[model samples]
Target: MISFRPVDVDSDAEMEMLHRWVTHPKAAFWLMQDFDVEQVREEYRRISEHPHHEAFLGLVDGNPAFLAERYDPGHVELVGLYEPEDGDVGMHFLCAPTDTPVHGFTRTVITAVLAWIFADPDALRVVVEPDVRNTAVHALNAAVGFRVVGPIAKPEKQALLSVCTWHDFQSATSALPRLGASL
Candidate 1:
């Protein structure tokens, strides 16, 4: 089963693991390619204390599998960038990089993260603004029923703004096998 625990400041070791994942070439859009462990920890430290944002470590069968971040788009990352809906939440995730990647692992991680978000009764929609050049995530987002609203220019990159409602996610994933089946 997939579970999540809030990320904390003392999580240095876990931060190291996260550091490696984000610095990998496959995670270019994550924009932490040059960050060291301490930098990562400090970054999360700020996130842990932020009222509008929180981060979690995703565990699959009790082993850390990925990092998931949830935020209030209206107050945090997307503030003034998009029209805010009452129940909208923003999300970001990074799956652990592996030498022997399991087929469908990344998809499973994203599905689990989406499931976790919608589990919150207040979450009516999930928002994402991934770097426009990240084609892999654009495809994944589409597969999971995220519709691009348009492009938005952020300080660091030009991003494709996407949104997914609970109904859309359910309809899209219903036609497929269960998310965790591949793992």
Candidate 2:
């Protein structure tokens, strides 16, 4: 089963693993490509201390599979990054590096992440701003019910802003098959 739990980024081993994941070539769009070990540690330290954001390490059958964060866009991610609307909560996820692409793994990870975010009573919508060229992630986001709003140009890259409201998400995905369950 895929699950998410609060992570203790203060742990040395966890920090090391996170550093490797963020710096991996496949994670290039994550924007930490040139990060050093110390920088990674410091970044986690900041996240751990931030009040508006919560970080979780996603696990599948006790194996680390991804990193996820849930935060208020008005406070952290979309502070000066985008024009945020009320009830907007930003989401970020990074899948761990793997040589073999596991079928349905990304879908499961995204579903698990969205489930966790919407679990909060105050969360009305989930917003994501991924690189416009990241077609893989755009497809995954759509699978979870997010629809594109428009594109925004950032200093680092052009991003496609997308949102999935609680009601829309519920309606769109209600009949969709989950990765592990038999259709």
Candidate 3:
């Protein structure tokens, strides 16, 4: 079963685990590989305290398995990053490091995150800006109902803008499989 809870970044072990995940090679696109542990700690602290964003620890069968965050595009992630459109919400996610990748894990993680976001009364759409070169995540995002809106040049890299409105998400995923029995 998969579930999400607000992360307590001040916790020592959780912070350490997050540090390792962000520094891993699989997390290269996250653009935090060169960050020190303290930087990661500080980043999490800021996110935890940010009013327009939220960070969550995802658990599968009671074990921490992923990290997910949601932000209002007009506030945090897309603040001056893009021309804000009404109802735009941004999202970021990173799966825990694992030697053996499991089938359907990405699908489950995204589904759980989407479920959580849709639970918010004011949320109207989900948006993502992943590096265009990250095909794996592009596929995962598409699986979860995000349709590419085109590429946007960023200071760091070219990002593929994708979006999923509530209606589109509902229509596309209505018959799709959910993450686990818990979802």
RMSD of each: 2.5, 3.3, 2.1
Q: Rank the candidates by TM-score, best first.
A: 1, 3, 2
* lDDT tens digits by residue: candidate 2, 1-183: 677777776788888899999999999999999998789888877887899888888888778889998888888766686778877888999989999989877777787778777877778889998999999999988877999998987777899989999887777678766533110
Q: How many steric clashes does model 2 contain?
A: 0
Off by over 4 Å in 1: 178-183
Judging by lDDT against the true structure, name the best candidate.
Answer: 1
Quote the positional error of residue 173 for candidate 1 in Å: 0.3
Q: What stretches of model 3 exceed 4 Å from their correct place?
A: 178-183
Highest TM-score, which number? 1
lDDT of 3 by residue, 41-149 (tens): 8998899899999888989899999998889888876556667677777999899989999987777778888877877767778999999999999988887789998
Models 1 onward score TM values of: 0.95, 0.89, 0.91
| lDDT at 53, model 1 | 96
Instruction: Give a tens-digit lDDT track for model 1, residues 1-183.
Output: 888888766866777788888899888889999898988888899999999999888888988888889999999888888899999999999998888999988888888888878888999999999999999999999999899999998889999999999999999888766643111
State which candidate, 1 or 3, has the greater lDDT: 1
Candidate-wise lDDT, in order: 0.88, 0.83, 0.84
* Global fold similarity of model 1 (TM-score): 0.95
Clashes of 3: 0
Q: Give residue 118's lDDT in candidate 1 (0 to 100).
A: 89
Which 10-residue window of candidate 3 scores lowest in summed lDDT? 174-183
